[model samples]
Target: MGKRKRNERIGALIKILSHQPNTVFTLNYFSEAFEAAKSSISEDIVIAKKMLEELHLGTIETIAGAAGGVKYVPLVTPERAGFFLEKVCKKLEDPQRIMPGGFIYMTDIISSPSMVETMGEILASQFLNQEIDYVITMETKGIPIALMTAKALNVPLVIVRKNSKVTEGSTVSINYLSGSSNRIQTMSLSRRALKEGAKVLIVDDFMKAGGTAKGMMDLINEFKGEVQGIGVLIATREPEDKVVEHYTPLLYLEEVDVKNRRIIIAPNPKITTKI
Candidate 1:
């Protein structure tokens, strides 16, 4: 086959890298695919990496040694992350978003594919350098963000159901106090959902008191899996004593006034500090 042009090779390389986020590929793979030399491919990768960094598109990481290769890691800078979340904050400020219990209605934003994808990229980037085996989240609302995060990390997504289902086969269940309601609630997971000794990153759409997140950590422990990290798309600022100590929340619900129909939200400081 005729030698491919430098532009053609770079475009193809970017496409391949973007499609397989957090997956490593050897230089030989690209060289052989494009019928080019290793050195030439290396130069192409350098150029591609520079462009990606300059544009704040993403990052390309190189691992050394014969067993290692280069991988693409998705990133959303603090400035961009803050800007995007600010837009969501504005949308949520509307009085119509206020619910009966002082909860802001965020179903529409959480369900939006574009919004979830962006937040997922930001959340997943935090755990990319770690040994993450699976992405776990409670079923329903959290599923979308968790699924997207798992996609970015190239890992499996596990759902912890609110109610046990016969279709899931044998399952493990646990009871935990509801942080917001001050009541008991039950959550369950399939016995086969995660393998023993796996490291899991928990994702959730909203966290009020973090009782549910704490329960998820307990469930992982029961299965002999390690809790690698916890992430919430949005969390309440009040009731600061979260049962789960460590977590990265994209946005924080600072204040909500039902009578005035007012809501205050901002990017979580953890997003800037951690990511």
Candidate 2:
């Protein structure tokens, strides 16, 4: 191929870095791809990083040494995160989302590819410096966001299942009380799923009393793993004291008044205050 133009090289560099967030790509690799010198590739990286930072999209970071390379970090700025979260709060506040038992129906929101992708980016940003080895979440509802978080962090996702499946091979199961229903429930994980002493970040869709989150923590402990952080999409305001104390929730569900047919929710102040 002929020598690529500077604009072409930068555009392609940004595209490649953005698509594989947190994964290092050596400057020499780009040098060969663009048929340019390492110095030219380094310059392209600088331009791409500046553009991303200026636009609040994300940033490109260059690592030094033999193992070092340029990688993209999907760090969401407080302003952009606040705006996106507030939009989600409005969507969730619709009375039509209220269910029979005062639960909010948010299938559409969490299932949206774009919304969940951004949510994942925001959640991943919270623990960017934690050096997370895996992203863990309970199966089913939380899988989408958890998977996306794992993608943003460029780590593997470990799912704790509600029940043991025959296909899971040898499994470790534990019983824990459900915070919402106040019933004893069983959660399981494959013995081989997690590595001993691995640092993990837990991501979930919702938290009422953090029973599920606590259960996950216990399971991680069984594998001798460390819990770096916990992130949830929404948490109830009434249960001020949750089973898991140190958790970051994107939105607070203040009330779901079934009789009044009103839902009051907003972005977490901790998140909005930073903006």
Candidate 3:
């Protein structure tokens, strides 16, 4: 193979760092990839880290000692996160999303692994400093993103279920007003699912009335656990005039005129929601 140029080395380093965000890299690892001496790769890393910091995209962390390695940490600026989410929101406007009552059916986005992974990381970044002992979500559609967010935060995932089975062992259940419908619905959790006072980060795939999210919050409180943050992949405009207290969303679909084959996709304002 031809000897790679300096720019090639830099690009490769950046690419690796981007994929494994917040992961440490050893000088030896870079030396092996570039087939260059440790000193040469070290010089390259210094320049690469500087460039990434200059762009305000990532953090290059240095470590000392035998087990020490460099890590690239992604900091998604609000502007960049807004741009990414706006594009994603536009994808939901497909005429095929027209379901009953003019509801935009977005099962695909919720179930997609790539989209879930990206959205999960963005939310995780925001709560990186919090005491996120666990990630919580309700069953059915919210499981994937909850699991992914849990993986990102390296925390346990607690799932709230619609009904409990004897096979599920002991569980704690609670009731709350559903945001989707003004009626009350009950949600359950397996006993011992979360340690007492654990700081839980609540996540869900979609939000309309936020009834389910609120239900999960009530359930978490029943366990005597603390909720550190709340996240949703998509937040739909409430058909009913109502609002929830605290939450963050990647994107918002303000309008979907499937009748006219038009749609409005926007970056959700950084939610002033925290609990």
Instruction: Output the number of the lDDT-best candidate.
Output: 2
Pairs of colliding residues, candidate 1 = none
Residue by residue across 121-214, what tens digits does model 1's lDDT show? 9899777768999999998999999999998999999999989999999999999887888999999999999999999999999998999899
Each prediction's total of clashing residue pairs, residues at least 3 apart in sequence or on different chains, is 0, 0, 1
lDDT of 2: 0.92
Residue-level lDDT of model 2, residues 140-203, one tens digit each, is: 9989999999999999999999999999899999999899999999999999899899999999
Error of 2 at 219 (Å): 0.5
Residue by residue across 17-72, what tens digits does model 3's lDDT show? 76665567898887777877788878888998888777767567778898898877
- Model 1 — which ten-residue stretch has the worst lDDT? 266-275
Could you tell me how far off, in angstroms, the CA of residue 194 lies in candidate 2 after the best superposition? 0.4
TM per candidate: 0.94, 0.98, 0.74
> What's the best-to-worst order under lDDT?
2, 1, 3
List runs of model 2 lying over 4 Å from the truth: none
If the candidates were sorted by their TM-score against the true structure, best first, what order would they fall in?
2, 1, 3
